[model samples]
Target: MTKILLHGCCGKMGRVISELSKKYDNLSIVAGIDKFGSDNMGYPVFKSLDECNVEYDVLLDFSRADALENLLTFSLKKQKPIVLCSTGYTEDQLQLIENKSKELPIFRSANMSVGINLISMLLRKVAPVLKDNFDIEIIEEHHNQKVDAPSGTALLLADSIKNSLDTETEYVYGRSGSSKRDKNEIGIHAIRGGSIVGNHDVIFAGDGEVIKFTHNALSREVFAVGALKACQYISKVSENKLYNMEDVIGLDF
Candidate 1:
């Protein structure tokens, strides 16, 4: 069995991963780490990694970026692969992750949904062809309780569009100020309200026609499932590299 130590085990996505992991015979969650320190389930829940005594193959982290330092340190000490599902990382933390990728296996994705990763692939293919005449904008929506705006997924989509642009593109957050849109500008807008699971739309507009690609996440299970699949994949791999959703789904970019 591929044993897992789940971070953020008490949170929404963490609970989802905990529940869904049981459906797979080869995968099991052996322990969990949550700030809330509640484990109604049979597994032990620790407040921090240093307190955990149980054995696990890989760590699946859905915790916040602030928790990365301790978690990354412990994972490195254990020589274990980790599926880091947290967003809102600082630039220094991201750089730290890149440096650690050379020492241990690390899996991180802007979005865990398989469909979203495929959307990233689609954006890459379509962006180059449409950039000259089309104006691009990215709009993302999430639940009001979410802490981050212009979600990691939104940035992922914007990055996809930016990579294909021949000219340097400026990222415009919102149209609050009174100014006309620039040709080299990529607008990213965030919407927060209700209990929205997730939604992303990338629009390309021209004089005559407009094209928009959208993905709607109806349930949190999509992300949970994707992370579990990635967990299973990473548990088996011996290579020390930073894997993305593409690595789990057998796609490039």
Candidate 2:
């Protein structure tokens, strides 16, 4: 079995991963790290990595962005590969991840759902073709309990679209003022209510033609499954590089 150290072990995603690990013969959670240090998983849960003494092969963090720096330090010091699925990182914190990846393998993605990653690839192909005439807008929805707005998947989708176009683009989040739409601006809107798992819709409008691409997540298992696949892939690879879902899926696991 590929032993795993699961961070954010007490949250919803953490619990999802814990339950899903039991179904995978090759993956297992050896220990956990959560702010509460709750030991509900039968494995020891440490409030801090400094107190961790268990053996594991990979670190799967589904925690918040503030927890990233410390997690990266511990993972790099211990020579452990980590799967980073957290979002809402500042520019400096993002740079920190890039810097640490030079030492150890880091599998990171804003969204771990395979479908969303595949959509990112498709956005690259279509955005350029539509950039000249079509105006692009992104709308994302999630559970009311989610703390971040526009969703990480929304920003990832935007980045993929932004990279394809030749012209520079500015992201306008939830526009409010009485202003006209600009050609170089991409509007991102967020909706939070009920228990929606996840929803993202990307629209390209020009003249009389419109193109819409959307993905709806009905269950949280898709992300958990993707994370496990990544963990399995990273456990076997010996490269000291920053990896993503593309790398994980490319391995054909």
Candidate 3:
């Protein structure tokens, strides 16, 4: 069995993973860490990682970015692999993750849905072919409670397209003043509303035709399933490196 240390056990994603994990015989949440402890959770929930005494093979983190430092510290000290599913990390924190990955296996992804990663792969292949003739735009929608604008998945898609192109391009987040849209600009727009699990649309517009790729997450289970997959992959891998959804899903980004 893959023993899991579930971080942010009280949060939405954490709770979803916890409940869904029960269906899998090979996965078990041995312990949980959350600032707000819950008495109802079948496993023990501690206020901090320092308080956790249970043995777990891997740590699955769905907490906020602010908790990353402590999480990384504990994981490194314990020599446990970690799957980071949090979003909205700053540049410095991201660099820290990369640096620490040299010591222990670390799995990180902006969006854990397998569908989203496949979309990223498709974008990388298609962007290079259409860059010269097509203008691209990305639209993402999430719940209002999400603190970060232009969900990380949006940026991931944009980066996939950006990296695939030979020429330089810029991201324009939600248009405004009368300046016409630039040819090399990739527009990204965000929509916030009630309880949207997640939605993304990538539009490639040419002179005659418009092509769009879309993915809609109806529930949180998609991410929970992906996180479990990552946890399983990281626990077995010996390499100490920063892995992403591409690595877990066996796809190249």
Candidate 4:
């Protein structure tokens, strides 16, 4: 069995992962870490990683970015692999993750849905072909409770397109105030409302025609499943490196 140390076990995604893992015989949530501890999760939930005493093969973190330092410290000290599924990390925290990955296996992704990752791949393939003639725009929707303004998946898609282009390009997040759209910029807009699972739209517009690629997440189960898959993949990996969904899905990006 793959013993899992579930971080942020009290949150929505964490609870989803915990319940989903019960359906798989090979996966077991041995322990959980959350600021808000719970008693009915079928496992021990600690307020912090320091209090966790159980043996586990890998750690899956769905906690906020603020908790990243502690999670990384715990993982590195234990020589354990970790799958980080949180978003809204600052540049310094991202760099820290990259630096720490040199010593321990770390899998990190903003969005764990396989469909979103696949969309990123598709953008890479299609962006270069359309960059010169098309104006690109990305629209993302999430629940109001999401702390981040533009969802990480939106940025992921934008990055995929930006990297593919030969010319310099910038991202404009929700334009306003008397500025015309730049030809070499990608526009990203965010919408937050009542309990939206997730929605992303990538639009490529030319003079006469428009092409759009969209993905809608109807439920959180998709991410939970992907996280579990990542946990399984990282648990077997001996290489100390920063991994992503592409690694779990076995795709070259």
Best by TM-score: 3
CA lDDT of every candidate: 0.91, 0.91, 0.94, 0.93
Residue-wise C-alpha lDDT for candidate 2, range 1-253, written one tens digit per residue: 8999999999999999999999988888999999787857868899888889999999999999999889999998899999998889888988988888899999999899999998888899999989999999999999999998879899999999998888999999998889899999999999999999999999999999999999999999899999999999999989888999988767331
Question: What is candidate 1's CA lDDT for residue 176?
Answer: 79
Better of 3 and 4 by TM-score: 3
Cα-based lDDT at residue 135, candidate 3: 95
TM per candidate: 0.97, 0.95, 0.98, 0.97
- Judge candidate 4 against the unseen true structure and give its global Cα lDDT, from 0 to 1: 0.93
Deviation (Å) of 39 in candidate 3: 1.3
Off by over 4 Å in 3: none
Candidate 4, residue 246: Cα displacement in angstroms equals 0.5
Q: Which ten residues in a row have the lowest lDDT in candidate 3?
A: 244-253
Off by over 4 Å in 1: none
Candidate 1 per-residue lDDT over residues 1-253, each given as its tens digit: 8999999999999888888887899989999998789849568999888899999999999989899888889999999999999999888988999999999999999899999999998998999898889999999999999998879999998988788667799999987767788989899999999999999999999989999999999999999999999998999998899999888889654
Encode model 3's per-residue lDDT on 1-253: one tens digit a residue.
9999999999999999999999999989998998889988899999989999999999999989998999899999999999999999999999999999999999999999999999999989999999889999999999989999899999999999999989999999999998899999999999999999999999999999999999999999999999999999999999999999998778544
Could you tell me the lDDT of residue 109 within candidate 2? Answer: 93
The stretch of ten residues in a row with the least summed lDDT in candidate 1 is 34-43
